[model samples]
Target chain A: MRCAKRNTILLLALLLTFAAWTSAQDEAPYYQSADFNVPIIAGWQNQSANEAAQFHKPAASATIRAAMATGADAEAAAAADLASWLGLAELTAPVYRGKVNLADGTWHVLARDIDAQRSVSQVARQAGDRFIVISFLESDPSSRIVMLAIAQADETLETAEPEMDSALEQLTGLRLDNLTAAQARALPGGEWLVYQSETALVAGSLFGNDSYIALQEGTAGDLAALADAWRGTLLGFFITPDNSPYLWLGITVSLLILAALAGSFAWRARALQKDLAMIEQLEKADAR
Target chain B: MTQHEAENPLAVRPQPRLLRALTIVSALGFAGTLVLGLFVAGTDIQQGQVQRIFYIHMPSFFGAFTAFGATVLGGIIYLWRGSEAWDRIALAGVEVGLAFALINLLTGSIWARPIWNTWWTWDPRLTSAAVMCLTYAAYLMLRAGIENPQRRRSLMSVYGIFAFISVLLTLFIIRIVPDTIHPVIVGASPQNAQGAFEATSGVVVALLPSLLLWLTLMPITLMWHRYRLALRQEAVDALKLKLLGA
Candidate 1:
């Protein structure tokens, strides 16, 4: 019977493993570090190493880098990160510096033209002693592309139009009405609402009721590509909070409680032995 | 008196080979499952290391469920057959069941501290679980307070049967009450589930063994030990009474 029971347990273990394998959902590909995670952008050269998640697009002449930097503030941290990657001395003051507040935190959005070919756009926010910086660099001599994420103007009505218009006005000092609207284009990432003029091209995608839009100038047709990549990283990347202390605390308390329960049984048994000894002494006195 | 002691079901005897084996197996299995949950499982991408607490938090509740189920069964049988053995089992269930319930309740509170950003909430599921723990705890207190042996056994038996309702409520309240932040691992979670993550293969593999061990072996082994302890306690009590009369 015991052998049969053992065989049944082994069979059940096998069945459980099979069920788990079948039931498990396909986990999305993510570039994970001890501190954070970002979706691995498809068709990009993965240049990530150490503590950072970085991806490069040779076709678009762009490299997207997400990392942490030590500085006094968000803007300083962003500048520090850009300096390390794009050669700090070669860059001048940003053409555009603005701030956008999202669900996670307030982000300092800055755009810098590094010499003539390379242009860098960054979003930085302070997280504890360090700062989280995601920089989008386009080294193409022909065109400039800027990627930005902003909270939706209206929560109930989610369309990329308002944010697209705002981006055009803010980035190029032009209205949305100035640009001709193209047919809604479908991509592997999601639906893109594209707007372009003679010089500037704009494309935006909606994720979690927020607008992730890309602005490009010159002869580059990589607005759709940049928009898709930005949408993937900006919307999905999350800093996995360091909460291991709570886990350790939970484990320690559980073990302590279990040990106490076990110890109580032994304590009671010792007391029982003492009681028996007392009973024996009393019985001996009465017998005498 | 010796004949009466021989007739009593609560009489002390050498540990049965089956019970001894079960105790060893259950202890080893409990340790093994804990190791699996702590080390073998992959860290959740979303919730981080704190998510590991789910392995213990969920299974410990089920452990309480099994123990309390035994209590209800013991209660019913004791009532029907008027057997002291059944009453001893019922009493053992309350003590052992309460410990598991406490583990479930406190581990949840600790987990919530990091995830939900709060130590405690009066959500329907949380409230029901707390009330369930309290109800079983009250069983132990009331048992000690009652003077008459026959009366205490019958009263607590009825209490044990009714208290099972709290366990059921705690188990299913998240479903019955639509507005909740508590995430379900099986089906679609509620709209407002805080710190929810998908149950991937790693979660399932770690959870399955722990679930099986807590459900079957741990409670049964612990309760059987408690049953023997209760018998020894009763025997000592009877000796004290006889000595006082002499």
Candidate 2:
């Protein structure tokens, strides 16, 4: 009777412990909507009238760099200014051959005629200047040119010029002054047209756009560098995806633990059976 | 001889001390399992809090299977060696297995309610587990209907061995074929595409202890209960002999 009472007390204690453990295992919420975002730009589009026949091909490419360069303070500021205008908190300014700014939420830039024989579209726009360039690249060739009106800045061009130059230098290796654009009559296939701010420029292409040659003109080393920077940014966001990885690990471990427990019980049953057999044999011997 | 004397030929058998010790240990182990289980957090990447139910559901199923396995093994031994001890152990194991299986089914349904968006599913694993539970239940009912102890033990032992084979088929069939209905968790598959696994150090710390306790406690408790049952049978036999003229 004493042994039975002790067993009962132990059973009660075990039950209490189990209840406490289960309550502690209660789950907590880990996913939130703010953890992920759908990227807006699926891919880039190049619009060049000379390559009208093969406009569907890849037209241009631009090198994307971090805004944290040693001399990129000026470029970073200008990128920040543009980003602010667009209501984007996180923005990385890419170096384009032309001066670009947010014009009523749309990117607008003006290119001046660098060569006397070349048209205004052939030359990249310089920093801190205003000029007339109303051609907008539409994916549909049949669509009419939508002339975008440039809005006058509240500040003078002289004050914004230095800031824009610094921002461009900081973001892209080439200073805003060195940026230039050129028009080629070949199909848009191989040329890399980079749209950094709002302004798009034709850099160079491998095959004409008609042939669908997607090669962009750049040293392999430079492409690798740009890819590295993009990868770094992506890594930061991977840790905090809407479905966090930590939670998955927890569930897996729990399953393994349960399996182990089952195995242990099976082992114990075997041991107990041996003991029971011995006791039964002893009882039978006493009866004999 | 009286009916009681005829029933149990050995009524004065002494209970073993080892059995009592196991009972104490098992009770303590069970307590520890419950405490640890409650404290561990059940967070999952995709299912959120609903995933915590996995811990309880899985262990219960595992415990039930373990008990069932013991029952079959005990039944085999009882038939081969013709030992009453094996018969008693088989009976106890089956009873405990049934209890745990019932708990497993209930907890699994509770878990499925929030995650699978339903209270019950006819998924292969769930169906098989249910069938296995019902079959054993039938085994118990059949035993109760019989009055002859020797016949009842022999039939139950045979049925227990057969039921174990059914359990094996139930557990392995879904693994052999693609189960389109119920999603697989933990293993690599499309079911894992939704990202429903995660384990942190804190969760491991809490769950491991609980599992250890359950593993230690289950067998000890079951064996103790079986011994007590045997003792009660002996007591009934002796009392009947005292009342009847031999």
> TM-score per candidate, in order?
0.87, 0.47
Candidate 1, which segments miss by more than 4 Å at Cα? A1-28, A42-47, A56-59, A86-89, A150-167, A181-193, A204-213, A220-225, B1-12
lDDT of 2 by residue, A1-288 (tens): 999999999996786576557656653321122222111112322222221101111322221111111113343434443343235565432323333333112223322221222111111112223211121122222111111112233333322223333433433344444545423332212223221222311122221111110111222222222222222222211112222232234344444544454555456545544544444455556568
What is the CAPRI rating of model 2's predicted complex?
A: incorrect
Candidate 1 residue-wise lDDT, B113-192, digit = tens: 98898999999989999999999989988999999999999999999999999999999998999898888888989999
- In model 1, what is chain B's TM-score? 0.94
RMSD of 2: 18.1
Q: CAPRI band of model 1? A: medium
DockQ for each model: 0.55, 0.03
Candidate 1, residues A1-288: lDDT per residue as tens digits?
999999999998888677657655556589988767899998899999988899998878888888989888888888888888666764588777777777778888888887888888888888888988988989888898888776788967667888888987987888878888664878777998888888988888787767877889888586887878866776677888888999999888878877787788778867975785677578668879
Q: How would you encode candidate 2's per-residue C-alpha lDDT over B1-246 as one tens digit per residue?
A: 333335544443345687667766765665555444444453343455545555555666666677788888889998898887888788777777776676667666655665565768777777888898999999989988998888988999999999987678666755665654555444644442222454454455445555554444564466455545555554554444443432
Q: Name the best candidate (by DockQ).
A: 1
Taken over the whole model, the C-alpha lDDT of each candidate is 0.84, 0.46
What's the distance in Å from true for residue A161, model 2?
37
lDDT agreement of model 2 with the native: 0.46
Interface RMSD of 1: 3.0
Worst 10 residues of 1 chain A by lDDT: A19-28
